[model samples]
Target: MSAFRARPPAIPTTLVDDAVTRIIRWDFEPGADTGVHTHGLGYVVVPMTDCHFLIEEGDSAREAFVAQGAAYRREAGATHNVVNAGSEPMSFIEIEYKQAL
Candidate 1:
């Protein structure tokens, strides 16, 4: 059983959904949140602008800062709610690798 509750739908704009990967663009306002959710597929995030993130998972939370153009990847099954912690708005590109069906 999972400890986290379902999160609200993330604000995302799908740019590409091909056989290989799903690419999405996300724009977040200050204090906005991307509700708690678990990743089903491994993914990569490319920052379009510098970002400050408050990530909450289960009973714990932490903050992260990534500069523009810096990219990071995460494996599947990561669960968390991502919040915009900075004063300004931020945007990023997310690419999720599709799993074999």
Candidate 2:
């Protein structure tokens, strides 16, 4: 198996008119994972490479094998832990929207 690799946030934070937008690109190798985190604002994920994702939700968890070019949306304030389970590196683009609370 290849060593796990992670990419840092591309755009930590940005001001867009009345709202703040954040963009990040991540690369995960097999058996790689991102520790638990919370999403304050809604987010959209666009996969650049195929990946098998394992998501932990509370006491339960779900797994999904997404193909390249797949797109997903997440609800605001959602929290979860993610893991990558695939032979090749998994890359994705994450876009977050932040508004005045």
lDDT of 2 by residue, 1-101 (tens): 45544632222223232456677777776767776679888888888888788887788899998888889888888788777766677777787777535
Per-residue lDDT for 1-101 in model 1, tens only? 68553433347899999998899998888887787789999999999989898899999999999999999998999999898888888899999988654
What TM-score does candidate 2 get on C-alpha atoms? 0.74
Clash number for every model? 0, 0
Badly placed stretches (over 4 Å) of model 2 are 1-19, 99-101
The reply for model 1, stretches above 4 Å from the true place, is: 1-10, 99-101
For every candidate in turn, the CA RMSD to the true structure comes to 4.3, 6.2
Best by TM-score: 1
| Deviation (Å) of 72 in candidate 2 | 1.8
